[model samples]
Target chain A: MAVRAVVRRSFYQDSMVLMSVAARLRGQPGVREAAALMGTPANHALLAAAGLASPEVKGAAPGDLVLVVDAESEAAAAAALEAAGAMLEERSRASGVLRRPRTLEAALAARPDANLAVISVPGAYAALEARTALRGGLHVFLFSDNVSLADEVELKRLAAARGLLCMGPDCGTAYLGGIGLGFANVVPRGRIGCVAASGTGLQAVVSQLAALGEGISHGIGVGGRDLSAEVGGTMTTLALAALARDPRTEAIVVISKPPSAAALPALESAIRATGKPVVVCCLGAASSGAPGTWVSTLDDAADAAAALLRGVSWSPRAFSDPDSVRARLAALGPARGTIRGLYTGGTLAHEARLLLEPLLGATGHRILDLGADEFTVGRPHPMLDPDARAAQVREAARDRDVGVVLLDVVLGRGTHPNPAGVVARAVRDARETAARAGRGLLAVASVVGTDADPQGRRHQVEELRAAGVEVLPSNAQAARFVALALRPELALALLGPR
Target chain B: MTLDAGLDQPLRVVNVGLELFAEQIEAQGAAVDRVDWRPPAGGPDIASLLARLED
Candidate 1:
């Protein structure tokens, strides 16, 4: 007679409750199994009880009470059960039980102010979750990466019909309402808002802005691969439009790591139409000019953003000026036949290609996208994926054509076993191999993340630089430096005539 | 029963029942806060009560 009345809700409605219950039941002694069902559908209850057929007992409705009991002492158990039941009844009467929200109708009835729905289910189930969220009149933040482009397009279209913001299918970082969502920095609230096509790049700017004592109204990360030739800038366009109308935002900072040329014009035009001041930071771009300000480095982007936030007017500095760059390049000694561009992020490779492509021309084929499918293979992140690319760097050092090998080392939370160790070993091995080949190999690299990262970016960059690889603040800067070393003439044009 | 003198320390009590608990505890010269509670399948247990009490 010791009755246990378990209240169940839909996974969509009461996930925390369901998960907590499952966890508790796993530890409980008397409870052999526990299942949370959406409804008292014969199939659902049967599935919950390990597919055992339920007896012809009364079935419970949505918020109805059902008691199940198994106790040795019937009288005591019944009395205890009744007491528990009475307590539950009293609690229910005092504060009504929330019915399991089945349809979009039910979900909306519960959380009317819920503007955004974040779907984090498996890839196959993501589309349904998104559809449900959209139908519930919620803006969908699709956290599920690797969703097909077709599915994304449909979801985006649906979101537009309801006049809602559909953030991303693989959107990693966002700062909404002065709160960090996903991998984001906690900058204070200010007039400057961002809609970036990169996560770490966006984070760098946000952190730097915070350091400068400037706040951010919002930092919307529009995924790294958004501006590629294939995807175009669907979300970027919508985000720009929304931020333009946002009263909190007085200025906008658009950041990207050198998107394809085809994608640039449309994005540029959108910014121009916004009328609000914009600070553009397309990493690896030699020069950029809009109706607003242009910045080169990630640090410069943050500085520009902070200045904008403070309503302080500022102009862009020419970091990639040719003559200045050539002077610096010429000042350095003879060609260290081998140089390593060690980078943490993937875009560093694309940035390196831009800088080196002009100098090395076609021979820049040595540029390896470490995070690319070919290199990383089954691994998660290129920098986090150990030994495979590290070994490649070792081999590259032995190649006679390989004069300078660039390494991009990105530091952030959740990056595998300290990146310093990986780069340190790679640099050590590469330098050793280059020396044996009777060629000097200079390891020129950059640390992508900031002090906000627990791995200690400053220390890691120092470690790599101390190990003989030149460490720059960003992957793009490192690539620029490598390009300067390779073709001093191009460097002269970029920095100004020496 | 007499109140535990140790309860003189700053304490936070979370009640799952309703605001009535808050009123009752306050009547007893103790502080209790009411919060939304959606207990799992097995319903409210000792651990949950402890968690609520801690909250």
Candidate 2:
């Protein structure tokens, strides 16, 4: 086998495009491993970790484009490299057919009255583009991650000062006027609005609300760190104010990874100032001493918000069908062991961890957000493609200590069309793997989407259930089910708060 | 309407990166302008420097 590296000076393609090129080459005959990347230090390290970095590759500059190919023969490596060059050229030609604007400025100039700019550039350039959009008086939905906290604070403050919304530096989901944006679910338009610091958290809430015969006014994501002490809930507060003014919005839901104690008062103040009933679903947030109706699970967030809209008293919900879920787990007859959670949404993973750890203790469970940076260094997020999570499912099943595997299949635009299928096959493989080892594995999961979603919610659930996976009604229910299964003595008490 | 575009006015989107996202927006029947984003020829380090200058 031969491993070779080639560098092209001053050639930069979109990182997503390069990653796709890498993925395509990996599928080619005789190719064992490949990566197409700009020679950033991080990329260099990633390539090196993959054993694709030759000594010549070690000296590459950030300005250079690098392709490292590992193949069955020297000739194969050269051929693959040539193929990579050809693909780039073809993509470049296809890009010209549209004659798209090369800069945000150029696009905005053409649509001077454009109100929103969805900035999804690489993190290094995202802030600059976002700044330009905000300066041009557009509400910014910034999708790029790795933006510094200082930049986030500045941009959000600037947006707030101008009476505009700056959604995220790492925000992945939002909906405006029934229009889904950046990994959003297609839910109907209604009076419930959302301000979330977690992407799947918002999806779970809105989709649940939709399923409950409620719809959304808007769902805004304020990046993950907005509620950190440093950023101090800048965009969260602004989004609340906007929702408050929004005529269609009767209530709001605020979701986040529990805000820092230092940031809570600011968040609470914003919730109060809205002067509207709000569903406060800060997953894993400490005891509710704040204003507005607070709920623990994303499921209850929807139930409470819809109830508020209906003029009915809101109550916390346990599981949709506790008896059936319990029976399913009992039938699995697994040993009481640790939980292994493989998740696509960071928020959903955080929710699952919080729900289980308090009872089971944190040490017994291993929860992972597959879309997290560690899993996506040189690959697509599991949301865009399900292979990473699928591979992890098989690996996690091999552990005798893992009793329950918690999974979430979040369906939306721009995500894999058949995430549920990939997960089903993975779970089936996991079950077979565990059975061969004379161990048992129980997989519990939830679908976070409405029936209108392209990958229909019911269809996804049926797929998992067909594979012997007990798919629950909501994320919180799935997490709680695992807890109940592990500690059957806890019983219905596990269904409710301890 | 001026402060919150989605309140009544149609959402006018300028998708600034990732061509696929633009296509999805368009597929949803929303009016969107695609920004064919390319990094600075010098790559991310140069992009960072350019960002600082833009700031």
Candidate 3:
């Protein structure tokens, strides 16, 4: 009687016996448990026939256990099994011919002219992929976010060494060599080049420039957190130097939402040394005695950049006259109480404080950075996170020291779906709480984005205004108005030209 | 039955098991040959042999 023999081998030891038979027996259907133990040719031939084993599997010896399985039949089952194994091997080899190649080797073989690799992998895997692409001698357009600062620095260093471009780890937007990569605005190519810290702000400036028939040589987005206290403005410095050197860029625009004082001096020095005409728009604040050009609002920044590109010097203009706001506040009534500013953007809150501190004598009013933990408690990006605003409205409304409450609502894609609802609810709650406390609440608010419906952000602005919150067009203007309400004296200071 | 015919030309054994068997045969200085076997092509009975191998 014919009998079936089944063999099993573990990878721990007896490695040699497994090699010979592994290839042939690996994918064959007839083979059950095939392993080599000690030195045995029994499984080696089986593996070789199945093509399951690697080239290294051929040298397996006896006294090492290799596994093999054979189905017994009245006829020669081994030959039939071997034929089946060969057919399977033929199919596998043919399958490769039938399928399109997806490996790097295949891509290079197909398109030898492909010089750039645009990577949009997950953040954690970005560095690895970037390193691989660099090793492969391809320019990288990295579009991943949440990459650590150290990784970015190291990657930038590697890219510089390789003489290749490393766009971003969290770089949401960029226009590279006239190609729009990632989430970039379609702006014409012109003599002006821009490097912005904020993504949406960059979009706004680029769109506005395009509208004015001005173009950009390049608009590099140095991830939002680059200019913050922690990162120390590393990418900004690099971008400034690059834009400065580019011959196509007759004028350069460096935009950020204000950097820490320590970061400013270094950046200022770099800009002054660039010798190229520079328009610096630190969104919510004026440059602190820096010599380069300055603009306060995003719209004005775009205007300045367009004018500079067209060989014209555009002076900074106020979005809304601070005096008008002060006059309006005075007309409302006599000095009521302390002013309160609850702002989404940290830079906006800082700007409001700068405007109010001198006028309110620093102690008369409060400026809260809703994005700050001390104010919002465990909330991130205050405009997107509703819980923070919910708590803030109640606190501001209940405080007897607070009479005027100023809010800055930032609206954009990747933000809350209904920012209007958020603002409306917060306003209603605060108003009710203040009314119950028998205090009059003067609520002034501002919308950050445009009417282009950037994720229906315009609706939020309309809702806030409809709900009786005095809405301004820009954060800078809103913060200025908030400051004037806090201190009538600062209004006069702003009215005087510097 | 001609059982002994072509038996001396080195038995062409195929180990269609898992990675362990592949590793073992690879170490023995013999090349492994792998083939893809599916149901529609009518291959040998693997489950019964596997059960026997376990036993």
Candidate 4:
């Protein structure tokens, strides 16, 4: 094996372009790992930690662009580097005739009427740009990560004071009015607005809302830590205020991985002030004690929000249909082994773990949030590259202890074009492998998308079902389905046939 | 005074980094100005730069 590095001197490019170029290189023959990153100190540290930092990569200037490939041979390394160069050129060239400015000040100068600044720079510099935009009277959509909590607090404070929205530092999705920002899905425009601390959680809820014939008016991403003890739900509070004032939103959904104990009061108070029907899906927390209807899963949050909008009485159920659960278990022969959840959405993965642990107690299950930093080191998120997680589904077939394979397909703008097809092919391959071993591999999945999504939610669901994968109605249902399959005794008790 | 006031107006954006974001907004008929952002000229004294920007 060999390592090679190329530093494009002082040539900066967007992280998405770099990630795509790197993804292309990873697909190249004999390439072990590929990273295309700007030459910043933080990136340098990441390369060093990953053992990919050559002296050249380490010595790169912050303004430089670094492309590194770890490959099978010297020839392979060099070839991948050349490929990276070409991919970067092709992608960066896609920038159209829009005037490009070097500084935010210059950008605002040209378009003084610009009310928003979408910042996706490296984390070391994300706060700086976000602050600049806020000071210049632009609501910020910060799509960068690795920003310090201190910086996030300061930036949110400034935005709050100026009555502006600062969407994220690690925030990945938001839809303001009809415009999709960051990695958002093509959801239907309707009356429900969302303020999310989890991007994919927001996606799951909004997509499910659309599935329920209720759509979002606006989806505000408050990064993943807006409700942390340190941040004190500053942005979430601000977003709540904004959503309250918006006439288009008749109801609201707020999603997070449960707020910090200290942050919950203020957050709940903000929700109360919205004077709107709110459904809170703060995963892992039983009840936020807020005025809004508190739910455990993103699916329930959407359901509750839809019901609120309809002025009908509603509460979450174990399964939307209980008869189907019993039928699914009976067909699978109540196979009981280790449950493996291979997921692309981090929040979805978290939900799976939350659902499975109570059921699989004493016994075991493995849930991999493949979108975590460990899995997505130099590569794009598994959302953008479905083949990675899809390929993992096949690995389950080889392991006899693997009882059921759980998966999630997230359909959105910044995601893979045909994630369902990719997973469907892998499910077939895994099933074949399992069949060869005279074993049954129960593949369960949830598609987080709406009919209006670019990938066509209904079509994606059909694709998964066609491959013999039990396409559960929601991520919560899919995870719970694995639990019921592994312990069929639990199914009769948890979800009785109607 | 809040985001609602701006939501009614056609979204005008100054997008820094990722031309694709600008393109996505444009595809939805919103106006976006792209910034070919680089680290500020003297490389980056990140902490100091953040302090200056905040001020």
Ten consecutive residues with minimal summed lDDT in candidate 4 chain A? Answer: A91-100
Error of 4 at A315 (Å): 2.9
lDDT of 2 at A320: 80
List the candidate numbers ranked by DockQ, top first: 4, 2, 1, 3
- The collision pairs in model 4 are none
Q: Of 1 and 2, which scores higher on lDDT?
A: 2
Count backbone clashes in candidate 3.
84
TM-score of 3: 0.55
**Backbone clashes, candidate 1:** 31
Candidate 4's error at A163, in angstroms?
0.5
- Candidates sorted on TM-score, descending: 2, 4, 1, 3
Docking tier of model 3: it is incorrect
For residues A221-325, what per-residue lDDT tens digits would candidate 3 score against the true structure?
666666666666666776777777777778888878777876787788778877888888886666768967888767678788777667776776544465566
Better model by lDDT, 1 or 3?
Answer: 3
Those runs of model 2 whose alpha carbons end farther than 4 Å from true positions after fitting are A8-10, A55-64, A286-289, A495-498, B1-6, B41-55
Residue pairs that clash (backbone atoms under 3 angstroms), model 2: none
The most accurate candidate by DockQ is 4
Q: Give the lowest summed-lDDT range of ten residues in model 1 chain A.
A: A8-17
Candidate 2 TM-score, C-alpha based: 0.93
Is candidate 1 or 2 superior in TM-score?
A: 2
lDDT of 4: 0.83
TM-score of chain B of each: 0.38, 0.61, 0.35, 0.65
**What DockQ would candidate 4 receive versus the native complex?**
0.61
lDDT of 2 by residue, A65-150 (tens): 89888899998888888888888879878778348777788888899988889887767778888888998998888888877888
